[model samples]
Target: MNGLIGKKIGMTSIFDAAGRNVACTVVELGPCVVTQVKTEETDGYQALQIGFGEAKEKNTTQAQIGHFDKANTTPKKRVIEFRDFNAVEKAAGDTITVDEVFAEGDTINAIGLSKGKGFQGVVKRHGFAGVNDATHGQHNRQRAPGSIGAASYPARVFKGMRMAGRDGGRRVKVKNLKVIKVFAEKNLLLVRGAIPGHKGAYVILEK
Candidate 1:
């Protein structure tokens, strides 16, 4: 009962009880099916493997097909294992809805893959102010990452310097987002403020 698998369904603004307009991200919480249960004695840990979303049988591997078959469900596009889950009594193929886990005004954390911004310069990637502004005959120094290395001391750039390369497309967790509303019938959850990733991306909601 610590977390559930879900999808980011975009955003909407709602007026809260305080009459303030609060931005909320809409998430389609599970109706996740339990695919497997690992016990401490058997797997050295206790966890529940849950599956959500539909997957094509052709795209699903033979091994995965059999795994889903044992759960009596179709292949799932997303599978996540929740460790130390103990609040609910569930077996394989049991569907868990949003209302079963979350209530209004619950502060939770959301984990998702952030949108990728390919290789970039330090200014855009790390919010560096750049070398300097265009001044007395200064040319093309505004966006440059200047003075990366010392003249002679050390004779090499220090490792982990704030230089830019690839950016984004990584797992990001946004914490302390309060649950605004929950539509159990539609399996949707509304939380205050924005979360990571683009629309339709899978997100893990943790209590």
Candidate 2:
């Protein structure tokens, strides 16, 4: 899949040609630099390693500096590799813009880290419906996970049982999102509907 590294700028609504309001998520896509190019004969596979965003030199290691030096670019905050990108001809030190890869109405897949919701209960985490009402002896167990295991038959809770714990902050992929608009001048891509991650979080758009 050929794609670009971008940041989830925010979300907003836009009026379509039918004059209907549609919600969309705004993403600041690449202008990424080709840091390394892998070939089948040389590296056993083909892939394009691109770099995005800027990082301070002082915060980067000497080896990393040399790696970026080969591409004739400064330190980058985000580096990702895309395998089998046949859309454009590229080499080390090449620059890839969003317009060159995507257009309006194109369907794309977005991969990103979902927002972290610390420790959560079953109701919010697993969507387990609690006691229907607080009428019959159900005082404080409304949001609790009723029964976990059998008393003496199993003697212990089964593994992989849904329970209250840490939630979110994991890799998530949202597929089939339509590209409502593309702003080449600003390197912004307006994708229809919501995507994973919070504002400013890095996301990968694949076609």
TM-score versus the correct structure, for each prediction: 0.94, 0.96
Give each model's whole-structure lDDT.
Answer: 0.92, 0.95
lDDT value, candidate 1, whole model? 0.92
Q: Which residue pairs come into collision in candidate 1?
A: none
Candidate 2 lDDT (Cα, whole model)?
0.95
**Top-TM-score candidate index:** 2
Lowest summed lDDT window (length 10), candidate 2: 130-139
Model 2 lDDT tens row, 34-59:
99999999999999999999999999
Quote the positional error of residue 5 for candidate 2 in Å: 0.3
lDDT of 2 at 105: 88
Candidate 1 — number of clashing residue pairs?
A: 0
Stretches of candidate 2 off by over 4 Å are none
Tens digits of per-residue lDDT for model 1, 33-121: 99999898999999999999999999999999999999999999999998988758899989889998889989999999999999999
